[model samples]
Target: MASQIQYADVEVGTELPAASFPVTRATLVQYAGASGDFNPIHWNEKFAKGVGLPDVIAHGMFTMAEAIRVVTDWVGDPGAVVEYGVRFTRPVVVPNDDRGGLIEVTAKVAAKLDDNRVRVDLTAMSAGQKVLGMSRAVVELA
Candidate 1:
């Protein structure tokens, strides 16, 4: 797919628009069913606490997907993302409530690379704490 972003216009240290994703208990349940990861820590608060977790936690993969939307949305094509990676620094405790939790993501173009590519650095935070560390993506621009 062709990228919506033009490589000639991209600049190092350009900040993309920030985005936020809500993580509810139901979200975790649906993700578990879809991913076949029936981990109790992601759905059962009691089991999560018993396992030494603060509460029911959102799946790391789910969080990663949510964070990358900032990049994909900006590039306007999922295929534009040629490489992506992140370190799970903290658990996003999704409380069993209507409000649940919110994951806030902010990203900036870190560097312009050869072959019409750029490195984007991402920051993911929840509940006033950083949840993902060293999150970065390489995208090919049109």
Candidate 2:
């Protein structure tokens, strides 16, 4: 299938719409169950604090997936993403409050490649700190 977004319309440095994902303790639990990553650092606050973390943290993979929503939402096809990766720079701390925390994601086209593909650079932040660095996605567009 072709991407809903035409590669011709996407220019270098074009910013995609930003999105914020709420990461609650409950969200972590559900993700743990779905992904089978039942690590205590993602759920147990005491354990997380014991490890010198500020509080319970969201899973790295979860944060990565959340960050890519900006690209997937813009491209309108998950399969259009040919490659994606990121470096976990900081933990996304999740408070036990009703609001929990927010993972704010923003992405921009960094380069246009051959074969209708574009390299998207992404930034994921939480609590005023950069959580994901060097985040990027290579997508095949129409």
Best by lDDT: 1
Off by over 4 Å in 1: none
Candidate 1: worst-modelled 10 consecutive residues by lDDT: 1-10
lDDT of 1 at 97: 78
| Per-prediction TM-score | 0.98, 0.98
lDDT of 1 by residue, 81-108 (tens): 9999999999999987799999999999
Clashes of each: 0, 0
User: What lDDT would each prediction earn against the true structure?
Assistant: 0.95, 0.94
Q: Please give the range of 10 consecutive residues that has the lowest summed lDDT in model 2.
A: 1-10
